[model samples]
Target: MIQMPLQDMIKKITDGAGISEQEVNDKIKQKLEQLSGLISKEGAAHIISNELGVKLIPETTGRLEIKNILMGMRDVEVVGKVTHNFGIREFKTDNREGKVANIIIADETGSIRIVCWGDQADKTSDLNPGDIVKISSGYVRSNQERNEIHMNDRSVLEKNPEGITIDIGPSAASRKKIEELAENEGNAELLGTIVQVFDPKFFEVCPECNKRAKPTESGAYSCPQHGDVTPNYSYLLTAYLDDGTGNIQAVFFRNLVESLLGKNAEEILSYKDNPSAIEQIKTDLLGNMIKVTGRVNKNTMFERLEFVVQSVDPNPNPDDELKLLEKEKQSVEAQAVTEEVQ
Candidate 1:
């Protein structure tokens, strides 16, 4: 990671704040010495930048490819095409409710998910599939076995910006059957019929980080990352899906649930308080065929194989697949008859 020179950073801060260069340098030196063994020179420079209200982006480092990104990197720039965009969901903290959006962007090298929070989430409302974008000053972190980029207040999001063109290769997901699903199979597409829609459950989430908020002994909700949150509601749906050969439990989050039930979390939560409304939603979804794309994992809590659905297509055509199966079955029956006669 390239860093701005101390002299150049000091000059910028002094000029921007109408302060003497000597005073700025002394302040930076004092901060560095105070935390002598704790932070590096680059970290000290970052502290100085924040203190002086200066945003730092290395001019010489250039844009990083998605393949080169590592966890804990900051102020990185990358350009890619939006391959998948998820619905914005709301969460509440002690202060108020906030929204978050997530999307998967891909370049020729690979793909990574970008999480946008608060007003930044609204900025992604106009983004569409295949749209080129440039993200600047973004933060990178790894979560749930995958690396993701986060756009915060300090980040910049540009759509179809000049001097950037990413070759977004095929984004189609590989199809797998329920019987063939293995633990940690990454992302895959599956076709199956919903055997049952279990009663949906709602949980409280922290508004700041969008993590689940656990209840405290004092009758308040708290998040590990963001303490003392007011708690916002989010829905989770578990259903059994069968693809002829086998069956597996599938879990659906807010976006997938809305897509499948045609209702958002708020609407779903309203129904949760009414038994008839909840049953109606179950009645409308059970026994329906769907094409699901998601990550396969082992549910350690339940000791069963589970699919965490990313998206759901409630209207999938299974006629062609059934025809092929019938044709193969007929061929096998004819061979069996010939063998019996012989």
Candidate 2:
């Protein structure tokens, strides 16, 4: 039920009417002139959309795609492949004690996160990456400025729905500054200088399943599924990155830490027992400019935003970065206007 984005409306008009985007813009400009600037640019676009017989409202299409699942929608059904399973998270508040399951699903159009609650949350127990999923009777809500589908006890989730298949490519990361981040982003790129780097904390993961291994009563760690066995080590490195406008705490996992510090995994593990061994490396990292693209995770326990680094680029081309950021700025502005009218 949310208002369609102004750019989306313009695209609809241009594509549906088989006219150039410039022509659509020219038409909107004429409409604004006729109205003597009484209406906003977005209003003019919507008027032009209607004049060109382009419908801005979402209709009940068969098997709705994630990208078309607009905000403020209810009782919606969608089918997509499970791209990621965030597992279950339990929360206890003053009067409520419950858990929610989160998973990201993708179709050819796009991807989105779905939050499952109550009995519906149990349905995610067996979900894995690359599994087709069908969700019915769900509602979409805005969380941290992004759209997410919510499933309550009334919703139904079908795992591996028959004859349903989805072909999706990789999702693109949005480029923005640290101050522009608000945890709504799925993946974001930030170019900043490392102001500080902390010692990495290493842990054990089951070699077979890659699940975290918990310490046994005897002190040796073991995975829940694989019993007592040798485990591979993983680590997370934390650093503060400043992009002039603001700064953010960024965390890089074991795989990306090597590139982040220009060191190998074995070299990083050597410092696990001797924390001071990394001081020189840490000092070298400070003031070094790098770019990171990753998920924006809110560390509930720490009560702060942390960027989970997925990819690292020690150097980026300035001219290309400026062009991308400018395009992103326009997209952000149009989304802001859409939210306003909604």
Residue-wise lDDT of candidate 2 within 73-127, one digit each (tens)?
8887999888788888888999998999999888888778999987778889899
Candidate lDDT scores, in order, read 0.81, 0.86
- Regions of candidate 2 where Cα sits further than 4 Å from its true position: 1-63, 172-174, 180-187, 207-210, 230-233, 315-342
> Against the hidden true structure, what lDDT does model 1 obtain?
0.81
Q: Which residue pairs collide in model 1, if any? A: none
Per-residue C-alpha lDDT of model 1 across residues 161-197, encoded as one tens digit per residue: 9877777655577778788886555578888889888
Structure candidate 2, residue pairs in collision: none
User: How do all models score by TM-score?
Assistant: 0.46, 0.71
Residue runs of model 1 more than 4 Å from their true location after superposition: 1-171, 317-342
Best by lDDT: 2
